[model samples]
Target chain A: MPLFDEKVKTQLVQLLSKLTNPITLHFFSQEIECPTCQTTHQFVEEIASLSDKISLHTYDLVKDSDIAKAFNIDKIPAIVVSDSKNTLKGVRFFGIPAGYEINSFIGACLEVSGAKEPLPQPIIDRIKKIAKPIHIQVFVTLT
Target chain B: MEITFNLPGLETIEQRTIPLDSSVIYDVIIIGGGPAALTAAVYCMRKGVKTGLITLDVGGQVAETSVVENYMGYNHIEGISLVQRFKEQVEQFEIGFLQGYKAIQLQDGTIKKVTCEDGNTYMAKAVIITTGKRWRRLNVPGESELTGKGVAYCAICDAPLFKDKDVMVVGGGNSAVEAAIDLAKLATSVTVVQLLPHLTADKVLQDELSKFNNVTIVYQHQLKAIHGTNSVEAVTLFDSRSQKERTLNVQGIFIEIGLVPNTELVKDVVALNHNGEIIIDCNCRTSRPGIFAAGDVTSVPYKQIIIAAGEGAKAALSACEYVLLKK
Candidate 1:
């Protein structure tokens, strides 16, 4: 059975039609030890099939340690979205991205494809003055 | 409680994007994602002012509600669904959204600066504060310790976790009564302990609650303490008139007394009323120049979603005028 119904798939297709650039979903999971890893892998695969602009690359966290370290993935069931040129846009989802977080995940994909910086000009100018590294981590729940 | 992944409306696969360019300075920064803030964003965008919204999440308090019957246009709509529609409308405009970020502090100056909890500081010419409010706690013994274990704040979020269990709601207001009615459908029984002689909720809500046979209302009783070992097992209530205390055994307790405005970020920057809500004029202008407030966080007469959205429009127009004057 399909995860998404036909109605939802049609809507998704229409939404994905707006994508200007190709996008890649890099999913990191372990075959064993992780419970939601397989489900996350399948979900991304199903979503990737909806748009020709979107593709999925699955990797084993234990076996492909080098690739996982390159992506700075510390946990299983992780997804990283990149642009057409395989350039990382700093979009990362730690968990399955199920529930209400699916909106966030799809939004990030669109953002990467559009490559439009939404920040206003003044904010960009102010951010340039920051001499030191400023790390920003936002905590969010699935609900 | 069973974790169901296929819950309807849980997975929203809508496609939307918020672009963030650190180099841009927004004309106005709205520090919330509720109805008021989203309305402000839409108005600001239409007025050709660059707007940015920083919030921990979209939907705010409305999303936490189960049903919204009072909001105009919709006879009855799920709170989350209403918020989703609001989000969709706002997405048509080009507004920057700093999603999943909480505003920790605010600095009022020529250019207002909002410091987020994630260490990012955003600058805006004008600021509209619509941070809204959160549920107020009982502050009694064991209430804080048993928060997630048994003491829940949102009935919509935790009601499913308490199937066939007995729960107690503490408040005399509409939210408490509504929560009792909502919980009564899922729980075996719901006991509402109000601190007043009569319910302060609207007559319509009172009437609806009266129809529920599983709900028990205790008037003129104050919550003394919550007693439990691992989770909430019972709550002691003191009858104000009789000068006697009684304990009722319940597995879960929902605190819906009222709400506390999220004005701590702007408390030092703007003038606040006795209730800690931001003091704003009819135009939604705050005491400080280049700053505005609307919605429940402000000294608004009503806290309804419609009123908040109207106040938000007013604040956005005022903010646009402020920006023009500065230029």
Candidate 2:
């Protein structure tokens, strides 16, 4: 059975039609150790199929340890979205982006495809003025 | 685990909004992302003012709601989908937009300064506050410690993890009853511990919940503690009438008592009511001359989407008047 119904698929197609640049989805998972790995793998594949600009790359957590480390992924069922510049921009999902999180997943894809609005010049200057590297983690939920 | 997808119909847009800048002093800067803020942005933009918006999330509590039926146009709509529409509407204008950043402080002056959590300060001639409410916590023992371990505030996200296990829901409002209904479908048994003698949720929700035989409603009961080491093991409930306490063994507990207004940043700046809601007059003007407030965060008689949107429009016009007069 397909994960997305026809109605949802049509909407997905319409939304993905707006993608301007290519986005790469790098999914890392273990074959057996990760409980939600299999489901999450299917989700990533299905999401990538929605847009021609989106491409998917599957990797085993154990086999691609170095790549996983570079992405700062320490857990299974993780997905990193690479931007148009072919660089990861901290767009990482730790688990299956199902339920309400699907909205975020779809939004991230569009953002990675250069569909995002730019930040202000002052905010950009503040970012450039940062002395040390900073890692920001976000948890998404309704409440 | 059961995976229920809340996939919304995707919306595509062009030239949505401009980036919010700190260098330019805005005419009006709204500090929220829910219905009120979104409506205010549209009104301000249409009124031909250089407007801006700052928020951590665009939807706020409205996004957390499962379904909404009260907002005029549609009989019923998914809360998130409605939020998406509101967002698209706001994006059509050239309003300065900022997301994933919260306004931490309000420095009241001729040119009010809105300090963000990112250590950046934004200035505006007039400000409209629409920061909505947040989920109220039980503040019981083990709740803060075992937030993700087992005690949860989001029932839709965490309900799947408690499959076939016992769980308890606190409160008697719409959110609590809705959480109980969701849990009863998956959990072995569902118990609702409401402080009131009767469930205060809408009649429809209460009726829907009653259809489930596995669910039990304990009226006038208060949660004392959530006992667990690593995960939730049990919870203590206190009965007001009996003046007794008892422990209910459960694997999970959902706290949905109610919501508290997000007025902490403006508590000292604005005149707040006893409940901490920002006090606003008929024009949505706060005690501060140039600062205005709307939505559930204000001392509005009723907290409804329609009400918030109307108040937001009024606030935008009032702020626009302020900016024009100041100039």
Candidate 3:
């Protein structure tokens, strides 16, 4: 069965068309003990297929443990969205980014692909003023 | 994060919207992103006035709903799908948008200063407040302390966390009944504690709720307290008729009570009704001049999506008039 319905797929394709630059989605999955791993991988695959600018790189969580650690992935079904040049944008989805979480996932894809709206100068300056290394985690409901 | 949707067959698109600037003093600034706030943004942008919209998230209460059957255009649509459409429409305009930041404080004057939680302030000539309501808390013991531990408010978001466990849903409204239904599918048991003798939800919702065999509804019972040390161990319920209290074991609790307006920022500036909603006249103007409010945050009769959108348009027109007159 398809993860996205036909209507949703059409809408998602239109949204993905805004991506001017290429963005890579690195999906990590394992078969055992990880119930949502395959589903999350399928999500990444289907979304990547929607746009030519999107590329999916699947990795086995157990067999590719070193690669997963390099990307700072500590859980199964983790997805790392990188820019055109594989530059990390600090965007990570720990679990299945299904349901409403797809909005944020698509947002990250657009942002990394250089289709993001420009932030105001003051807000930009404020972000630059922060000296500490910040890690922000956002949680979304999938029900 | 960005949201992009250009519609199916639109060969052309309008001018693009830019990010709101703190240095620019807009003619009108809306302080929300719900149906009301988004509608106001469209009106303000169409009026050729410099407008800015500051919100934590677009599509407030409407986004969290499961389905919206009476949104005028569609017969039936998912709540998030409708929200996505609303957001896409707003994204097309040239209105200045500041998403993911809330308007923390509002100072009224010729040029009002709307302070966000990030300490950055945006100035405007006329301010339209559309920051809609939020989920009302349980206010009982351990609710605040054990928010993430066990007591959750969003059933759709948190139901998966209580898989195979017992959970209790508080309230008897549509939200409460829906929470019970959501939990009953995954949890071992679902208990609904209603304050009244019967559920206040619609007949359809009550009928659907009765189909779950694992679900039990206790009428004339109210939640007294949530007792837990680390996580939710149990909940204390109070019976009104018997005037007795009993404890029930549950690992999770979903507080599906009603919502309260997000009027903490403008409570002192605007005159509010007994329900803590801003008192707006027919023009959506508040007690103080140069300030307007709309949607669920105001003393509107109906809290439907269409009503909020209409109120937003009125507020925007009123605000534009105020700014032009002041000029």
Best by lDDT: 2
* Residue A99 in model 1: lDDT: 60
lDDT of each: 0.85, 0.89, 0.87
Q: Give the TM-score of candidate 2.
A: 0.71
Top candidate, metric TM-score: 3
Over B121-224, each residue of candidate 2 has an lDDT whose tens digit, in order, gives 99999999999998899888899999999899989768988999999999898989989999999999999999989999999999999999999999888999
- Pairs that collide in candidate 2 are none
Model 2 docking category: acceptable
**TM-score values for chain B across all models:** 0.88, 0.90, 0.89
Q: TM-score of the candidate numbered 3?
A: 0.73
Write down the TM-score of every candidate.
0.70, 0.71, 0.73
- Model 2 chain A: ten consecutive residues of lowest lDDT: A134-143
Please give the range of 10 consecutive residues that has the lowest summed lDDT in model 1 chain A: A115-124
Candidate with the greatest DockQ versus the true structure: 2
**What's the C-alpha lDDT at position B315 in model 1?**
96
Q: What DockQ does each listed candidate score?
A: 0.09, 0.30, 0.11
| Candidate 3, residue B162: lDDT | 97
Please list the residue runs of candidate 1 whose C-alpha ends up more than 4 Å from where it truly belongs after superposition.
A1-143, B1-23, B242-244
| Docking model 3 quality class | incorrect
